[model samples]
Target: MEYQESFINYLRYEKRTSPHTVVAYKKDLDQFVCFITEMVGEFDVNKVDSKLVRTWIVSLMEKQLSPRSVNRKVSTVKAFFRFLMKEKIVETNPAVNLPLPKVRKKLPGFVEEESLHHLLDDGFFPGDFRGVRDKLIVALLYATGIRLAELMQLKGSSFDTKNYLIKVLGKRQKERIIPYPREMNNLLFEYLEIRNREIGYFPDILLVTEKGKPVYEKLIYRVVKKSLEYVTSFEQKSPHVIRHSYATHLLNKGADLNAVKELLGHSSLAATQIYTHTTFEKLHDIYKQAHPRG
Candidate 1:
């Protein structure tokens, strides 16, 4: 228990892991400790063996957990034991020999370009501050393809309107600049005007609540979901869906893979390469419909 807490703190303060990642690692570790305690009547890190770890994997599979979820949990166990090994508290790493299940790769979901066009150009958003702010939220996510956390962490000065770029602090605190349309810059300026009038003063943060406080994750999720429902019928209407649309659309329009990778703040080209699959699918569809080989 002490070790788990210390590991979590290490992830939080030292590794600078995201809050969502830290929470997931904590949950996985807690479940593993519970499994060990129930089987051996005590949770001793040194007492853990490959057999015990295998049994826990079996239990997770029996519960019908997806292979990907099971694999992530296994990764948590491996990371934990690695820490113990480094601290000289464990003689052998039981999780080292533990096997993981293979996970299926699913294509990312995205809204169609026409649907997004209608949503933004049509009379979907309101004329009030909330409407302006909500529309701007959707615009920024789709236009720049930044992650939700990066948008939430945006500051008033994050935008360089003259240069047509917005600086984003992405994962691991790595910073990158993404260009935006001149139209989006004007929209943002209008939103800030309304925000200033409503709050009676400018807040240091961007994308704040109606009351002028910094926006949280859930609120942004709701804003994106609700705004998207106005134009599309997709089941997944999260901010990430908009991000996927941004990437897929860029690739569909013949944007360079490496250039799209930079806009999305992906650490590697491999991560951005997934959009190519969707782009190829679209091209195949067009070929099937337009080709007259028959």
Candidate 2:
């Protein structure tokens, strides 16, 4: 229990993990602790064996956690055991040989291009203060294929409109420069100028509301949903779908897999491979039309 408190403190202070992440980790750890308490009334975690760990996992399976969720719990337990080992509390890690729960790979749902175009076009109320900003938010996310968190971090100082590039901070604080079309660069520049001059917004963010505050998650979602409502009839619509649309369109137009991987800020090529599935589906359609296989 003392060690758990220390580990949690380390997470909050030393690691600087977010409240949400720390809470999730604690909840996962507590579930294991509760199971151990109920099983034997008062057993030391250091004395736990692989057999006990396996049984606990079997109990978790009966509770119907999804494979992915169970796998995450397994990962949390492994980390906890590793921490104990580092502190010399245990002779061996008991969860070492525990079988990882298998997870299915399902493709993320993304909006089609026609729907995306209609959605973006609907946000083009040029005269209103927030309308223009919201439209650019949607456009820039699609144009650059940046993550929501990365997009939220952008400042007025980051854009290089003259060179048609936007410098972005990607995963693990790594910075990368992404190029955009001339039209996008122009749109961003125009929005920036208006943002600083007419709206009197702090010239720090490329996108902001009327209050000069950096846009957050709800704002981003609202912008995406509002634009989507105007353009397409798809029940599923969000800023991430715009990103998916960008990646999908790139592949449909024959962009290299490696290049798309970097543009999307993915840590691995495997993460970017989902777009290839979209391209393969499109290729099959073209083949069916061009070839007389039917």
Candidate 3:
């Protein structure tokens, strides 16, 4: 367990995995370690073997975990064993030969373009400071397709109005400059004019609470939810829903796959490829409506 904690730290610093992901990976491996600890009545990474790994996996199956969940747990095991092997702590890697379960790909759910228009129209009127700020948040998300965490760290000075670009800190501390449209840029400026009007202290973040605090995750969530609630009739509404909408809408608009991928800050084109399904579905509908084949 001591060494396991050390390995988690290594994941944090060396691998640069998010704290959330590191915690999940640790939980998975700890569960495995507990199983082996109970079976052998001792803790020794060297004592692990393929049999115990198989047994634990079977137990997970009995517990009714989805194939995707099982596969992720197995991946955790593989990473842990590989880490142990690298340190010469284990004679052989038990998880090296372990197999992953296959899972069907489910397309991401996103808001329709009409729904997005409705949502934007529903925001409070005539330049309410918070309204302007929240609307800009929505516009920026759609325009740039950056993640919530990346958006949170954005600073007042990060926006380059001349180029209509924003410098955001992304996963693994990597920084990327994402350009937005004139509309989003103009909305951002309108929000900026009201930035310091609040009573209490304010953080240097681009978006903030009315009391001048840096915008927390919950505030962002509520902004997205409230805005979407008024504008659209969608059953599911969230920040991520808009993110999916952003990608799907872009692909539908004939934006290049790799270009959208970069805009979304995706590490792999494979991840960006999923939006093709949404674009294809739209194309299918257009063909059905326009083609007079009957």
Query: Which predicted model would earn the best TM-score?
Result: 1
Instruction: Evaluate model 3: give its TM-score.
Output: 0.89
Compute each candidate's TM-score over C-alphas.
0.95, 0.82, 0.89
* Global lDDT of model 1: 0.90
Question: Where is model 1 more than 4 Å wrong at Cα?
Answer: none
lDDT of 3 at 133: 78
Q: Per-residue lDDT tens digits of candidate 3, residues 71-106? A: 899899888878887888876878877765668888
lDDT of 2 by residue, 1-294 (tens): 887787778677866655656888899988888898889886696678999889989898899989988888877788778877877888788888778678997666667777667656554556566767877888888888888877888877787768888899875567899998788766676787777787675656667777776778898898888777776677777878888889998888889999999899887999999888878878998898999783
Better by lDDT, candidate 3 or 2:
3
User: Residue 262 error for model 2, in Å?
Assistant: 1.5
| Cα lDDT tens digits for candidate 1, 173-213 | 88998999889988988998988888656546888887878
- Candidate 1 matches the true fold with a TM-score of 0.95
What Cα-based lDDT does every candidate model obtain?
0.90, 0.80, 0.81
Model 3 C-alpha lDDT versus the unseen true structure? 0.81
